[model samples]
Target chain A: MTSEQPDWIAVDWGTSHVRAWAMTNAGKIIAENGSAKGMGSLAKDEFEPALLELVEPWLSAQTTVVACGMVGARQGWKEAPYAEVPCLPFDGKTTKVETHDSRLDVHLLSGLSQMKPADVMRGEETQIAGFIAAEPDFDGVVCLPGTHTKWARISAKEVVSFQTFMSGELFACLSNHSVLRHSVAGKAWNDETFETAINDAISHPEKLAGRLFSLRADSLLHDLGNAEARARLSGLLIGAEIAAARPYWLGMDIAIIGADTLSGLYSRALELQGCAPRCPDAENLTLAGLAAAYLTLKETSS
Target chain B: MTSEQPDWIAVDWGTSHVRAWAMTNAGKIIAENGSAKGMGSLAKDEFEPALLELVEPWLSAQTTVVACGMVGARQGWKEAPYAEVPCLPFDGKTTKVETHDSRLDVHLLSGLSQMKPADVMRGEETQIAGFIAAEPDFDGVVCLPGTHTKWARISAKEVVSFQTFMSGELFACLSNHSVLRHSVAGKAWNDETFETAINDAISHPEKLAGRLFSLRADSLLHDLGNAEARARLSGLLIGAEIAAARPYWLGMDIAIIGADTLSGLYSRALELQGCAPRCPDAENLTLAGLAAAYLTLKETSS
Candidate 1:
């Protein structure tokens, strides 16, 4: 471990994983670490030790920690109440966590929730806050694709409304657990198959169930290869999601925040839908979100 | 172990289990037995042993054994090639298996497959054939709900056309494997939830992806009960299937051949859609279909 003391710590704790970044006061990253101990694995008391296990090498006697995501959920380190929409992703407030280590000061950022449509997001709100932090005056839709893909409308630096889709989860379950598993067992990308399936799904979204079973039947009757099956499966799901999310991205300035391959696929899908979306790295946005929270904590303390 | 010689044996061998019925010369079932030995678990050579393991007690010096479902699949006891649609479910011709035991004469019936829309059914075809045997002049839509539900058009003793939906499989996968698992872990059926979800899904089928995640979020935010979650999951899937199969079931005489609860659910959904379908016991239909095949075999031999 380096002898140089860190300025503060930024953490993104989710359901199945924890990621931390040690940073200088100026927001320059000094070190990065992570662990499989996510909120889902830890009890309320274990949250502190789980965090320290990963970032102890970089901690000082009295270092401040700014964390986002599920770690701030009701079941996390502490319940940082959600900032209800028609409001900023975070209302410039962080809940202070009581820690056993006298030297540790932790601030957990709250998430965002919507009532009318019944929606909620934990970690992604911080990422949205970070994106807005970079573009202070941004007003448009931000699409975050993941296990539970989210689409949110931002107007005047506040989230107006949002919707969540189980597209990624649906794709995984159908491909790995359903009858389609045998057909789409391997990785092979067929652009034509994907595009065709996507278009079909969008055109006739009601046929989704029938089309899903065809993948299995086609493999048995028509010798449909694994790649084509996989591509068609992905295309059908993404197409269905996009069809449902049309009101959010139709003829609007849109930005998608997600990982590499998934984001690329979303980008291509958007382009196919005649909307060229600006793509950004999801990890960067997460760190920037934690940095924003850290800066706010510092300002409040001073 | 009664010493009375059995006349014939009927089998409904599917992917997960095998059911057999020993009958008299008058087609009266004297004994019924089965085992976990499904087509999926047996190799070509093991199928004979699997069958013998269950029905050996009923075997005589010469016993006629007739089988249907996946047992006649390419991977089953023997390949009983599918009879093309616009034809009888079985063309009075069964694939005879060359058995090691001279006392056993086995005949496997073919399933029905449609080429235009690309669909196939193995075991369900036997159920349909049985229905046709009971109602020879019946001409309408037959709905068989199961792991892979089949909707078929029966006219003039032929399966004119058919479609398969993965509704049951979708429900199982989403409830057990997807993010919705936490929301719907146990059997808690709420009628209101099921009816409401079915109506909504049928009205706006595209919103399915969005509505699915809401189950999880609602459980987290609104404390949605597991019963409601389970009911809604089922409603959403079945509703989508009904919407897609509208062409088959709409304004037509519909008969549902399935197990008790699932068939009951389908009957309710159809009734909600303004169609009261006739509910038939799937087991009875299978046995009747086997009897029809047995009768045909005897006629040809005599």
Candidate 2:
């Protein structure tokens, strides 16, 4: 964006948390800060100001700002439309978000312009952009597993539609808060159990939805230890995701981006599905996308 | 069991809550009270005083008490032995409980006992006894569905053995507290969607566990409304329980117990399984069980 040594403010606003990074023109982190409070909390107006405080140290008279995530959704400050599949950085409409400080010209990055019956997403648009920046010529599929695990088929710089799975959220709720908690211990995972569940699920997918109750009975009837049960439950959920994401992953190389604990799970799961796994450095992609968005905005708006 | 009408105390103690019912000689309610503090709330000593206060208003020198539930568990006042299935009143041990009030003679009922792999229950034993009191000659399976649904096979006035399913608890936590909440709207049941999930589960029993992630995806893909999605999710869970409970249900008639709203739901599910449904009144069952336990104690002892 700015040719100056210190340029724009980069933010990744997620559902449960917010992460902000101040970057120099050369793409080095000037400063980084984060908060547990995310888009799920606060009124839309409170968002920009709260974020401003975190990057206040770096905010000068002309610092360009770009943000991604649910903060650009319908519930966000302004609804950023979805960018359609198979496109490059911030393919959707970018908005000039309101800021308390006029000196800080913030460019809220538009998400992907997804066209089906509707349009959606603000954050993943940036993520896809960053992925393209890092691997500009790559063409395949990327799976981002979380509350909603999104599997996108990417060709060149654009996302060619995608499928979303509720695997992560279901796993969390079923394991921790539901009766399955007694059956499945916790975060622990066992490979044997995982593989067994995957095979069981893949073979009889129609029964996959109903097997949740057996988690408890299986634990009580036999000693399906907590770790095995948890891993088995994970397999059951992610296996379902693989089924739903099949159309997206068909004939495509799959790259998974997440922390080691989470991405490793997907990698293992992908391997089971006979797909090769590509594990990328998440931080690098995020910064690359943010910088790319800033660069795009600088060129277009200048 | 007491020939003479003297004030009686009936208690249902469980892991986390304690409920006491004060009844007349003829089982008419004199008063009732409860406490959030349960066996889980205190050590052995603290139980007496806290329990005393909960029923202090009806406490008198002439009181003969028979208590049920976890008050007799390993964590309660003293470990009460379990009553084996085909549960009849007094099948369990009679543990003479000591208290600070010399005037009050409390006979804490025994928990349902299993000698083999060793599993038992305290409060549910009383509930089964109550069910028997309501339908003294009935023989089949009675399901007390809740956070833990207990299915007991009754014959010859003995319960044989019962299996507990954590159905309601799972349903509550998922609908109210989990990410699936966003995917599922409304709390009411939708028979069509529910039946689909149930059939899906039944068709492929093994994969039932894995299909759970489909709730959110189906919601997103298909235009099923949230209320229907919630009901379908619930049906998916309960169907799994039905599958697990298959052993206990074979050759046995089904009696579902709960408020009409909940019990009706179970009845419909039972119908789906081709089992006839009979719902005995639940409002009076707990108290009736206490009465049965009291009467049994009176007959065997002085």
Candidate 3:
């Protein structure tokens, strides 16, 4: 909506949504917009129109568009194959898209994959890059809590290895689709209950499946409140993830990069295990990561 | 429809479906029917009509209909309060429901509950009772694997204690709703892959959350087939359950009562841990349990 013309575009195109920011050549934001036309909802040819729907007003002459996330997936407009891990987050290796509009020069960033554990991440690599961009000398684990939470070991500005946990997706599925849906209906939370559940799950990770059904039993027999049930479910899921991820965060510097609410829970869970983690605002980091990619592309071309 | 009037009716009304059998006084089945009108689908007031719709043709004057399962839940036709465990699965403790039609005399069976660990079961109690009826000396553990799998310790024909696992529901939720849904799409299964996954999960129950995500990653990177992914998912979940229910099955007489496919999986998983479990057909046990309750009622009345 800005009257001034933009120099380039930055897009964080994920599975369910597409976020775009019109930025000056200096990385200063001019305007921003987003749409529900994410990679999941769009066909191969529809990506251009979906992108143009949001960034059309900011466009002038030929402008470079840099994007990250699932837009680089196989089903995306153009597949930006994953780069193996134990390398830099981003190094100007982007997949160029052939667009109909001459004013659009689109580039999708490469995601990172690990060969041994057989894991791959698309959007998170950008956030990790942004974190590295902000803290070049940062050496430790970067925990990104999200739909598929990622735990990456970073050393000397390089991603050594990473693991992904489907805790967020599992929470969504359990709360909305599974039998626990009836028990955890409300949005209310109990911190004490959460802590207790986390401790129980972390201490006895094997009992998790049985403990899950106990939520429904507690609701039926003991009148466990919906809020407490919700907290307990979250705590239990996060606790299990933490139990498995102990080796990654145990005795290492940890920074949790995500939204306040999820990050807060992760921070509290880590604190319970005698480790302190720094929570960084997720949006800023995503934008920073896109900008980092943009700056690299510009430098290489120049 | 049968020309002869039935002596009584046996019903297993669960969350999603209502199954009925027209039985003679001597427990001879004359006809059987089922409907989608489960306790979950019908309101309290509508339960009678739904029941009559399926059993009306089989009903005779003043027929006694004994039903089990979620039909006795709080939201069911009439709340059959849960009986605490350490007692027989069914001991003629039935909740009588007032019906509009004089021809219908409905008695809903009480489910079992455990207070300490907090667990409850509706229809599985009937299956356990049936198993005990067939093997009156079943002095070990009875495992009923279904939507909410139940593991009950049976001693002297009593359900001493029990635990419920949401592994079935978890499997349904993850394979149908989560990111893994895309990976595990076919009905195909691999026994070897399933066995390997079970061992992996049983050995390190803590790594379950991480392993779930790997299915998706493996599909993307290593061309993991849908059948292999599905089998692996099942193995991991059931293995975790076995790991937690070790106390219940280890060095004990184990009887698995459920549908053939699921019961077979539980049997195989238990066998992997050096336990030989007897797999019994679940339907026969339900009818046996109902007949047991019906006979007890008739004896008391006479």
Candidate 4:
């Protein structure tokens, strides 16, 4: 807990975890904490207590709290609703929640949605807002890799369109539940093997179904190393994603916002295809985006 | 239990279950039984007891038992090494296991392996053998759809080469373990929806990564029914498989051997691609193959 009282609080609550930050008036983070209590685990009435438990020390009389991510989802504390595409990432359109405690004023940020592709994103929109906030002139495709990676086209301070890929989730499911689980049971990796697999998948995306079983077969037949099998599995899934997302990244300025390890793999795959991508720290962007939303809430109230 | 003693026992011991049939000297089934005691659950020493528990009433003095499937795998009861491809599915090669009871005389059949692409199959080999035993001139591709679907190119009573696809397992993994689990719950299926998704995946296999997420997005945004989602998920995976296995099925006589529901889906998907594949009952073929192996054992012993 921080000695100084927080002027406001910023929260990024997602599916599996909740993260909070105690911010000063000038957007300085005085303290930070997180818990496994995420949207997926909590009930509608339990959100307030879960949040309060994490940041009670920083609370004061009439302190305003601005939250983003799944906290604003339909099944969340309050449905902030989705602001469709061709709109700014954060345009002061937030859902204000009526808390029982007089000192607690909670506001949830709206996520972005696309109608044509039938795609929707929560939490990621906040990260995009932060990326745009940091580089106002950044106009290109922004790829946010996670359980479900999102690729959004940003132009003129608005999201033109976006697509979502479940490659990360597919990788996890296949490596854990499928027959390949026994072959790729370790965290070890082989870069050369990964590169080869990426090329194979990119060239023949149709063969992905057939190629997946080869990992297990090779392990059983020629003693294919667990690391190589692991790397190849990752490469195959990511390569297929890159192949499907060609229109988004081909001959376009690109920025990849994700964790170092995953972003690095994406960077390597793209670089193999002769494209360079700028990678930004994901956590910092989330914090920056939440702070931006907090500033907007303060302005509207004043 | 049957009053008459069995001459031999035909067992299809796979990963999840052990099925045994008491056979007469003239290939007549007197009784049939199975248990959850699959090769996956039994240790090397425990396989004898599991087999005895199921066939104790049928066993007599020196009862010959012919077993196939994962029972011959390296980790199974006895290691019956894989017989390389371009060879007969089950020739005269069989691994004999020493049992504690003198009444039990057991032999495990060999699976097939492909060296170039590094593929292997255990239980499906017996099915292929059965297919060949029934139709002695099946000089084309034999598709066995299951947890791990196998596509074997047959030529002149030999398995020239083969490939394995995890589409079935992939479908199970994605629907049960991935984020799509929430959207694709239940068994309701829409044929029209399935057909459309099949064509989409077959045409643009590269776009599969992008299309998968749409199932979830459509469910969330447009109320895509669980039935439609389930069918679409199955279609996309099976379609991708058909696209990948095109080289094996193109212009070649195709035969699908599996359970009714799964084989029907594969047949439907292939029919959309202008190919008519023969659907054979998987159980009858397994028994025929095991009987063939038993006959070979009797001849060699005599």
Candidate 1: which docking quality band? high
Model 2 RMSD, rounded to 1 decimal: 5.1
User: For chain B alone, what TM-score does every candidate structure achieve against the true structure?
Assistant: 0.97, 0.85, 0.98, 0.98
Measured over all alpha carbons after superposition, the RMSD of each candidate to the real structure, in angstroms, is 1.8, 5.1, 1.2, 1.2
Each model's lDDT: 0.88, 0.71, 0.92, 0.91
Off by over 4 Å in 3: none
lDDT of 3 by residue, B179-257 (tens): 8999999899999999998999899988998899999999999999999999999999999999999999889999999
Off by over 4 Å in 4: none
How many angstroms is residue A140 displaced in model 1 relative to the true structure, after the best TM-score fit? 1.2
* Arranged by lDDT, best first: 3, 4, 1, 2
DockQ for the candidates, in order = 0.80, 0.20, 0.90, 0.90
Model 2 docking category: incorrect
TM-score of 4: 0.98
lDDT of 1 by residue, B97-208 (tens): 9999887899998887778788889978888888998899998999999999999999998899999999998888888888788889977789999999889989999888
When candidate 1 is compared with the true two-chain complex, its DockQ is 0.80
The better-scoring model by lDDT among 2 and 4 is 4
Q: Which 10-residue window of candidate 2 chain B scores lowest in summed lDDT?
A: B113-122
Instruction: Output candidate 3 Cα RMSD.
Output: 1.2
Residue-by-residue lDDT tens digits, candidate 4, B30-84: 9999999998888999999999899998876889999998999988999998999
